[model samples]
Structure formats: structure tokens, C-alpha cells
Target: MPLVRIHLDTDRTTARRVLQLHREGRIHHESREAARDQALRQGRTPAGDPVFVGITNGRRDVQLLYDVEVYTDATR
Candidate 1:
């Protein structure tokens, strides 16, 4: 499946929150830009610590695309 990577500002809390929302099905979109725009609209601003929101088939792609740490070791 194609993936969408959403770039976010530096904020661990907000980043995780957005990710959580996506995982929980609160946020659903097929495109990266759409997800990013929706995230921003939901209050995840691109300010200090930049984070990335990604929609992918798995977490590995998300980690690579966003250069963010993820807990996928168990899956591997």
C-alpha cells in the first residue's frame, strides 16, 4: 500500500497524540498531505521540535520516512 508522510513540528507529545489518533482510527486519510493538513487543523502545529505523521502499511516505513524512532522490534 502507498504511504503518506506528514511532517510535524518538534513536540513529542503532539506527535504521539496524532499518531495515536491515527492508530485508533480517529484520523483516517489516504494521502499524506491530507493527513498532515488534518493533523495541523487538529492543533498539531509545526513549531519547535518537528515530528512526522505517516500512513503506511507498517511502522517500519514510517520510521524510515520520518526518521523517527518506533517500537517495531517485536514485529521483526
Candidate 2:
């Protein structure tokens, strides 16, 4: 997917540059499902498609990607 980086500009040149950067893996990405799951947990979905997400990082500062149970040494 070609994501628009409005921070640069909305022109076609900027769009092309963003695409190039994305192809070079310079763009950061996260799971849409993760975002959706986190949003849904807050009682609303985002403006895009809905999807099921696993234990992705909700607490960005903690740098943890699993459930709290896993972090607390609880067995699944």
C-alpha cells in the first residue's frame, strides 16, 4: 500500500518519494489488526476496516508485545 506522508507535502512528488522510501523499508509500520483491536477495546473502531489482533504491544513505553499474563510469568 502507498501511504501518503502529509508531513512532507501532498504533491505527487512527495507521494512518489514516500513510495520510494516505503519500498526501501524506511517507513515504520504496525499491524492494522493490532491498531483495530486496541481501538475496539476502547469502545470504538477506527476509520478503516476491522480485524482481529493478537497480543501486540498496547503499552508502547513498556516495549512489551505479549499479554500482561505473559509478562507476569503466568502460563497460558
Candidate 3:
């Protein structure tokens, strides 16, 4: 899959959640839909489209950023 990035304006809780997951080394969901759905509400794990959505159909390795911007874990 290709790597991409997105800037999201979010709160601390959500940012921390993503950061921790990134530290663990992967940001994944059952599917892109699940990720997109998660981000719909406040304080939820942010994901979807360019972030969690994979090009070839699979889980994406997402890395965390300060505050909250979403991008795939390029190092992986």
C-alpha cells in the first residue's frame, strides 16, 4: 500500500490514543469502515480513508503524531 498523511484538528485524548497505538507499532481496524466510523465521534480513535484505508485491501500500519494528524507508518 501507498503511504499518505492527513492533518486533523483533535483533542488530547484522541491524540494520546493514536500515539500509544503507534508506539505499539500498528494502527489497524477490521476494515476501513471501522476506522472511519471510529473517527465520527469525539474522543474516539481517528481513522479512515487515506489513513487507515489500504490500497490493496488489508490492515494499515498507522503512526501517531502530536495533537492529531493521521498518516500511515511509513517506516513499516
Candidate 4:
């Protein structure tokens, strides 16, 4: 299993929205899953996707960090 950590430079509001959406089950799984889907859809690996992870309020941007681990076999 490889552990992947993604750091998103976002504001507080965005992070809150992500948490809310995840809690509401409006999307499948965690925000990390959504991020992975979005990354993969864009032809990129979820482990190395460049994204913003936070909310921007005025001159401040509160960013959130995410850690995702994927278990895989030797074949993968």
C-alpha cells in the first residue's frame, strides 16, 4: 500500500464545503475520493494531482491537507 498525501492551497470556506458535502453524502466516499475521481478524469494520478484545498476569505486563504492511502498488489 502506498500512502499519498495531497496538500491543497485553499480557503476555509472551500474546506468547510468539502466537509459538508462529504457528511451529507451528496458525493460518494470522502472528499479524497472526489479529488481522485476528478484527477483521474483529467488524465492525472490522484496521488499527484494539483489542486486547491481550502477557502479564500478576503486576504486570507485557509488551506487544508489530505492524506490518502491506496493498497495495491505487486501487479499494480
Clash totals, every prediction? 5, 0, 0, 6
Q: Kindly list the per-residue Cα lDDT of model 4 for residues 1-76, writing each as its tens digit.
A: 4644455555566677876765665532455556565445544444443333333344675545554443343222
Ranking by lDDT: 4, 1, 3, 2
Candidate 2 weakest ten by summed lDDT: 62-71
Q: How do all the candidates rank in terms of TM-score, highest first?
A: 4, 3, 1, 2
lDDT of 2 by residue, 1-76 (tens): 2111111113444344445555675632343344445544544424444322122223332121211111222222
| Candidate 3 TM-score to native | 0.33
For each candidate, the alpha-carbon lDDT, in order, equals: 0.39, 0.32, 0.38, 0.50
Best by lDDT: 4
Any residue pairs clashing in model 3, and if so which? none
User: For all the candidates, what are their Cα RMSDs to the real structure?
Assistant: 14.7, 15.2, 13.5, 6.7
Clashing pairs in 2: none
User: Which residue ranges in model 2 land beyond 4 Å of their true spot?
Assistant: 1-30, 49-76
Candidate 1 ranges with C-alpha deviation above 4 Å: 1-6, 28-76
Candidate 1 pairs with clashing backbones: 8-51, 9-49, 9-50, 10-49, 10-50
1 against 4, candidate with superior lDDT:
4
TM-score of each: 0.30, 0.26, 0.33, 0.43
The candidate that wins on TM-score is: 4
